[model samples]
Target chain A: MNAADLPSSCDLVVIGGGPAGLAAAALAARAGVQTVLFDENAGVGGQIYRGITATPVEDRAILGADYWAGVGLVDEARASGAVIVNGAIVWSLDPARRVGVSIAGKARLIQARQVIVATGSLERPLPIPGWTLPGVMTAGAAQTALKAQGLVPDGRTVMAGAGPLLWLLAAQLLRAGAKIEAILDTAPRMNWLRAAWHLPDFALSPYWSKGLALLREVKAKVPVIRVDRVEAHGRDRFAEVAFGSASGERRMKADLLLLHHGVVPNVNLALAAGVAHRWNGRQLCFEPVVDQDFGTSIPGIAVAGDGAGIAGGTAAAERGRIAAIAAVAALKPDAILPQVQAIRQRLAREEMGRAFLDVLYQPAPGHRRPVGDTIVCRCEEVTARQVRDAADLGCEGPNQMKAFLRCGMGPCQGRLCGLTVTELIAEQRRSNPAEVGYYRLRPPVKPISLAELASLPISDAERKAVER
Target chain B: MFKRLGSTGTEVMLKVDGKPVRARSGDTVAAALLAAGIDHCRTTPVTGAPRAPYCLMGVCFDCLVTIDGVGSRQGCLVPVREGMAVETQLGRREAGR
Candidate 1:
């Protein structure tokens, strides 16, 4: 859909098409309010269920049932009369709920009564040496290629890092008949002890048996090595992976090195839009400060899904529904949202073992806060040493460090390196991440073309002000 | 770096760095480059270092390429099209191109 086809105003506008956005848009539109959802991807399933409708993979079991669950979400949103616009880039959102969206390289401003920012999560930056090499990609990227294009590593593949998604991606790749060199388990041994307190809840949670089965499935096929440190080594593209295990440091020839630690909220848009955010030490990232209804400090705006906080796909959908019901209640005071209470209960159940997972898979400080020549900011190619040196020179925060070294001032707008930079600065300054803070983001959050900006429909008074 | 599992989608013909490449119908430009083993789509503007699609989910700008007459378009976000002309961005895109 183009900007020309979109409504100038809507009762509700969702900033994503993932599980949360789809659920929120569906519930809002079903309550008789006009709803519109804008997604950057070509499809509605977001990252987790990418290519749900257009996947080239024929067999459903190949990508697994959890991925296929996104189809029902897309269907529900479409059937609910919500305007789901794919390939639409939302560049700006003001506290007043005015949204600047660009579609097909054409920009338009849409007024929304209520907005749900469901922009989901992105993989955490793994700042080991040589990570910027061509063949080194996040494990989520591998999953996207597998699900969206039925693509898998055709050469020697080394999977590194710790998280449920790591094992999940490994199982998916194995299912796709891809060869694996070895799995470098980066979950620090100390994490197991720290995470043991949350083990009781994890044992009762739904992910317990599923996580075990996934680990078993992948372990049965490939060698899983518990590694304390890992580094990607290549001149241009990833060719070898060097890792330190209990046995000792080992290096092996590799064609593709898929790295993943965990995922953090993609907070660029939310932060740029002036939503209040706080550093989450447990999650090891900055997340939007939100209320029980997922409402941010900015009124009329709600953040759901992993963007609000990482709680996996099921909880994202439930949170989306709850946010949508809240939106409906706010927009149409008489709107009856009978299932919100039940949805919240389900959401609580979905988030039962999240603490366990967070503590267990929390990336080690050595990996998160790199030293020496390891690159912290891929965009500016800033080394961790440079950032630490700047911090030692009294660089207060990420924003200050950006002026000093341009670490977070790249095209990615700090999505890749924001957490790493913040943590690095904090570690150097002998301060907590909360005290050190994050990048002060502003719009246009995602880069928009000059042509697209020029194409915006100008108001008469605004045009007069600029002309004079 | 990657290969297709199922060869079922309709064939999309495009050129990468002016070389003819065949990709699936649903393939994005990044997927096509990887499927064809054409790593390092663009050299970084800062240091001219070779880079490919690191995230493939649109967060990483490493996959920025020139599609047709346009410059610095995210390869992973743009879908593959027939007769598409993809150029490997050598460095920073020239101003007023």
Candidate 2:
């Protein structure tokens, strides 16, 4: 995890240390290709298996079996002898497969013949009134705190919005002895019809049992209300949550408000890497366009994990392995073909139940495009009305919206608000999100401190070349 | 504000704006601050309103704080260390060379 023996270049560089990246790096290393894995987190396991090495057996039990299952994977990865670099934030991944990395506040570039992008996904933005309040947080945030630090909400936490994570968190917290006031489910009642249509595939797959268990645990302990409209109201911090149901609106006092509509691919790194991306309507997120075997439009660059799409952790790991097999085979002509074939078979099997989950957890249309004065860009505080108004004035795409309103310009750099803006613009223009387009990402993809940039360890010759 | 579940880890003491906060050894700066009832991690540059960690992961970047004099570090990602000095990252400011 140190940069002490780090190299300036490698045969293959994997960006992200999540399930996919871990599998990719381990496989490539095992195949004898010089590999290096970069992760921003302190540990290797991504969000799903976060703190796996640190959490005790009893603690693992509380996190459930799916998380505990990753222990073996992490062990296998560590045994692979890959050069693992933790705390390395990949700021720029260009088309030429050059990765600009910042480690311990120092900047360096990694030149790789091939790069695997497995940056994973972010929670779908849940924009509502009082969402920016100090007590408001995404369900992923709550889960990350718990997974990484074993922290659980100490006060009356009101869980809102919809998605698998919403119910899963409620179940987890209930097990942790945390106080949960209620759950405001935002999925349409009609979504059951859509979910039922895919039930056959879901029942035959591995996720069915786990999904049912989460639902059972949440229903047995918590009061669940099915609703569409929700808003958090407070002065300084979140004081209460107001939501609507078929029975009409209801209000409840809350110490914390955790929101999550769903998750979407965190494609900033991939997009910044100059890969082609298409917006996925079913998942309501932008995903990189990768061909079968995870090779991006650009050769030698592959994307896996939720960064390519929200295929869950199990499938993401398989996809990662598949991408690794493919990339390594291309790099090393003598690489075994049978290994790649076996991984493909596993990946296909692992991907079976995704349709059911996607249909069942598809967020309500209201969430994708919030109406009224709901804020779309949290960083700049641009409202839906303002974005719609801009679109009404012939605003064409998200990039232009950025110029007019600064929607994607923030410390977060469009991660939180980009999809919302695209959806908003698409809604006004009467086109789909893909046709409406996305933000043109520029480097450094992650904002590097000026101090770090100035102190970049360029040799005098390299500096002179740049000066020339 | 949160607490550990299932098991206990070793505890570490850190400071937030000169105020002492006790946290588990592996607790992120944001988690420690939250456990100590300090919700407002930073003030925004645009509105000057108090903001805490929205996404405990690095995606939101709302948890930015000064850790050991390094400005704009994500509090939710930085593990708590003994005697670490923390400050709220508020507004636009220049970093000195």
Candidate 3:
């Protein structure tokens, strides 16, 4: 389990099992390199493409069926000789591509010549008053529950959020026989006009049609409402959700309230490893700056997927393939760059199309600014007013806000509030949110116990080597 | 590409707490459990809210249940194995707590 105990070295070590990691491992193994794929989840595919346990009621369901197909891809990669390790929570990554992994209560070090990072992203929760209530859940979580687990959040549910995921989850809930009270789409009014440019790209596949079909089906089944704001009301658990509509503040009694603002990259590993990143103004994320080959400032290390930025599964898969090809070329110079270039070009086209769609579907500016009493950081119980107060008191950046108000210093490490805090600060400071920038993500993304780190089987020699 | 569901009639049987449950061979434990009308999987320690696989994927811990004496097994991830002893976890009693 120690570094030396590894097979001397592997050609590539992929840090996630989502589309990006799965694609990278499959391509690297196909190229005749020894590869190892590791994921914290027992199953592969990150959050967006979470595996479904049951046979989907409909074959053309966008999220469920497509996600199950990823399992087949994982099997194909394993069949191609890539070592697949599930339920392996990778804690740290050394500069030398040495990964610290905890598998089944055992800690081990995996060394590889090249590393591909595809850790993916997490849901960005808006700190509304009753957001932390028991019945309140993320839209992704709701979809995962119904699609994969075959359990409804409740018999009656209200879906609210601002992304494609919101509509997608709403449709799925309708199919599961859950009486959807209403779907509140918080996407800005301007997005549809802006997103029209990307319609041609979406027409490339029937997948987009399937998503629209789901929406239409949901519209037929339930009332779809477009609201500017939503407020969850309850003493302990969520009892009802109130939305501000043109008519007035309408309240609906519901057992389940699903919210989806958007997603932020899981940047803890990159920050822990000291990778240089810049604030992406458009996507509102801190993404590592990479070259054409996905190589970061740290050579031999590459990043892909939403962890790199907020691109979808298709982009992540392409980026993974590109990183794998680049990693192979690093070890074997004879590998031609033309092949990589062709792949990069195709990926760029797809990425541009997705980016256009994202811009078209971005959340409205008002959702970024919740009511004063709304908690911004549920982990630390910091309210939106506290973040604003901290900003007024010379706390400019999210990191400083964390220091002054402890806003982003929680278990989530600001993945939920980092962008929202930045935007709030920017609004108060009369500057761009990008100017305030992102919070630094420390290592051990998911809190690892001190004992777990100490028990890692990395030998003194390996430790010394890493230190050197 | 495989044809969409509603076309396949592939059937598989796996044990849930030593009882045979009918499921498609590739279906996850959570999927099969749902198809079989087994709702309550585990309980949250703090609130004791009955949590049935919130996120069938491993991201959400709501679906954690004991499978073959292994506590906190993700029902969505683990393929239903023959003779697998599946038990509902009462609360968060792992050592990490």
Ranking by DockQ: 1, 2, 3
Candidate 1 residue pairs in clash (backbone atoms < 3 Å): none
Worst lDDT 10-window in candidate 1 chain A: A335-344
Candidate 3 residue-wise lDDT, A1-468, digit = tens: 232244646778899988889888888887777888888764666675564323344444434565566666666676767888776777788777777777655666667788998888877655666776656767776666444434454456788887667777776666555667778777767787877877788766444676677678778877877787788887656788988866678888887788887776777787777778887766766788888777898878899877888877777888888888889888776654337767777677666555555776677777777658786775466778888877788887888787787776754567667777888888888888657877876656554556666676666998899795
lDDT of 1 at B92: 90
Task: Give the docking tier of candidate 3.
Answer: incorrect
TM-score of each: 0.99, 0.97, 0.80
TM-score-better candidate, 1 vs 2: 1
DockQ, Cα level, model 2: 0.69
Winning model by lDDT: 1
For candidate 1, lDDT tens digit of each residue in B1-97? 7877879879999988778999988899998999999978999888999999989998988899999879889999999999999999988986864
Question: Candidate 2, residues B1-97: lDDT per residue as tens digits?
Answer: 6766745777788878888878877778888888778879888778787888899889887888888888788887777888899987777544561
Q: DockQ scores for all the models shown?
A: 0.90, 0.69, 0.14
Query: Each predicted model: what fraction of the native A–B Cα contacts (within 8 Å) does it retain?
Result: 0.94, 0.72, 0.14
Error of 1 at A50 (Å): 0.4
Every model: Cα RMSD to truth: 1.0, 1.7, 5.8
Stretches off by above 4 angstroms in model 2 are A1-4, A336-338, A466-468, B94-97
